[model samples]
Target: MKWIRARLADGNDEKGSACAPGAFHALLEDDRVLPVRGDPYNGHERTGEILRLDDVRLDVPVVPPTFYCVGLNYTKHIATEGLKIPDKPDVGYRANNALIAHGEDVIMPADATKVHYEGELVVVIGKRARSLSPDEARGCVLGYTMGNDVSERNWQKSDRTFWRAKNTDTFKPMGPWIDTDVDIENMETVVKVNGRESTRFHTNDMLFGIDTFISTMSRYLTLYPGDILWMGTDGHSPDLADGDVVEVSLTGLGTLRNRFVRER
Candidate 1:
């Protein structure tokens, strides 16, 4: 089961969020009474017009967005990059642009010397939460999805913090789709740079697991229903070239694909 919010991008249309309530629990949770005007997820609910997927574009899945991201979430990434290991998890900061939906072109600044793509598993929030225990964190998760925390390396590592590095316009590419049934907390993900595997890591090596990370972050800020935790990449962020097809993949949510082409 999955939960998503979608809208038609071809023309001016109102977007909406819905539960993909199916025999699956995530789908079961959707309000079947409210059907989407179009989209595949609507057919199961019989609430809205079943729009052809090819006919409309997908927006970032969640609405009423609250974004929370992490740094150094993966352990192998730290080891491989020869980065200083933090005594505790490095929850450096969260950004404003990490809440994007699917089918959006991630921005690549014209003046940037180097920009890298981070393939990660994203945890989406299902309820309003604050200071949750590790055990309670997963319960509040709406599901797991894929994302690319596109970063500008110089700005991220050299600048004060990652604010300018990771938060560029459309830097967050999420959701070919979302699924709640999968064990995304334990999945292995890989980032392909122009069809070559750059970084791949299993979640077992993460210094702080999803539960602990989410719980820790909520303490610093209020997390709302549509909040998301962008799991930082697994180190091997290869530089992207114009017209580069950057693909990120997780075990259950499949591949979130986006191409990097310089704006004219």
Candidate 2:
């Protein structure tokens, strides 16, 4: 089942209502995200009214407890650039403040150029996990979603840490909804810019899959519910500019489309 966090277009602004801030979980049904009344973190009980998909605005699916990401996880993605393959998965942290929902604008700082897009499959943790084995990792996942890891290449090359390069506000575009049922090994990622295809690769082409990252990270720190793990991207993207529309399509996962605008 596909799940979303949204507010009703015309509901009351009161907390816990359909109009409240990222108010509640909604199940997708025939062009609508019907609000699931109960605690989505625990159960899928229907609590209140249903909202049509067009009648509600999408929000970052969940307020993640921690936002984790991996880089160069895809073999083809790394090999394409002739980059060295790492012996182990390289993990990174992204700012939740940078996250934007589908249809939001990704700001391109006027002084910065060489901005790029990395279309990735994102993992949403459903249960608390610690020191999990690779086999146990799958059970902890609630669902999968899509993400666009927007980067500023120049800043990336100069900064020791990817602060401004990767954590710039509006850098991460994820959502539309999370799919509870997907074959991780069979998903494909396709990226487009201004209607032109820029990148495409299989989701499972990763040098290290979800199991590796979860197990590895869990060994050092606890992974909590609502934590998001971006599985990284494959292929390359041309430098993005103002007025560009980027669409990241991950097979069964809905497309996450966002426009780019120069920060004036």
Candidate 3:
């Protein structure tokens, strides 16, 4: 099932009142959206009211309890940057304030130059888990989504941490929706800048796979429902300019499109 968080385009609260007030959870069917009573982490109960898919504006699919990231997981991307591959899986963190939905503008700071996009696959956790084996790790995942890990090369290199370089507001563009059924092992990731292909790679071509990261991380901290993990991207991106539109598409998962705008 494909689940989306959206507000009706009509600007009225008629149908939205049937669900969870603000941005409601809807089941995406053909060209229609059926509002659900609850969220994906809980159980999705049908509200019986269906709206045209075109008659709504999307919001970030899930506001996770924690935003986790796996850096330097791709061998090709590691080689591209002249960096060594790590012997073990390591998890990093990202801020929720940086997250924006599809079709939103990525505000490029005025002083930021050499901005680039890292298109990645985002995993949505369904159940709370801890210290699981690779086999058990898969059971905890709800589904997958797409994320554009926008970065500033200059600040990334200068700052000891990625506080501003990567976590600036609107820097992370994620989701049109989340797919509960996707063939993770057979997916491909393609990135385009202004409608032209910039990077493409086998989505599962990571130095360490999803099971490795989940199983490894669960050893120390608890993985709760609504927590998201961004699987790192492969290859590199060209320097993005203001007004450039970036589209990150994964097999089965819908494309996430965002435009970059330089703050004046």
Runs in model 3 deviating more than 4 A are 14-17
lDDT by residue for model 2 (1-264), tens: 888887655554543554336467788876866777564577766755765687777887877989999988877767865778899876888998899999889998887888999999999999988999998988899998999999998998889998889989999889989999988778889899998998888888888888989988888989888999999888888989889999999889979999999999
Of the two candidates 2 and 3, the one with more favorable lDDT, higher being better, is 3
The TM-score values for the models, in the order shown, are 0.79, 0.93, 0.97
lDDT of 1 by residue, 152-255 (tens): 87887688867768877777778866687897547788777678887777855566778888778777877777677876767677678887888788887767
Better of 1 and 3 by lDDT: 3
Q: Kindly list the per-residue Cα lDDT of model 3 for residues 79-161, writing each as its tens digit.
A: 88788999999899999999999999999999998899999999999999999999999999999999998999899889999
Whole-model lDDT per candidate: 0.66, 0.85, 0.92
Error of 1 at 134 (Å): 1.8
Query: Model 3 residue 246 lDDT?
Result: 96
lDDT score, residue 178, model 1?
65
Candidates 1 and 3, the one with greater TM-score? 3
> For candidate 2, what is the lDDT?
0.85
lDDT of 1: 0.66
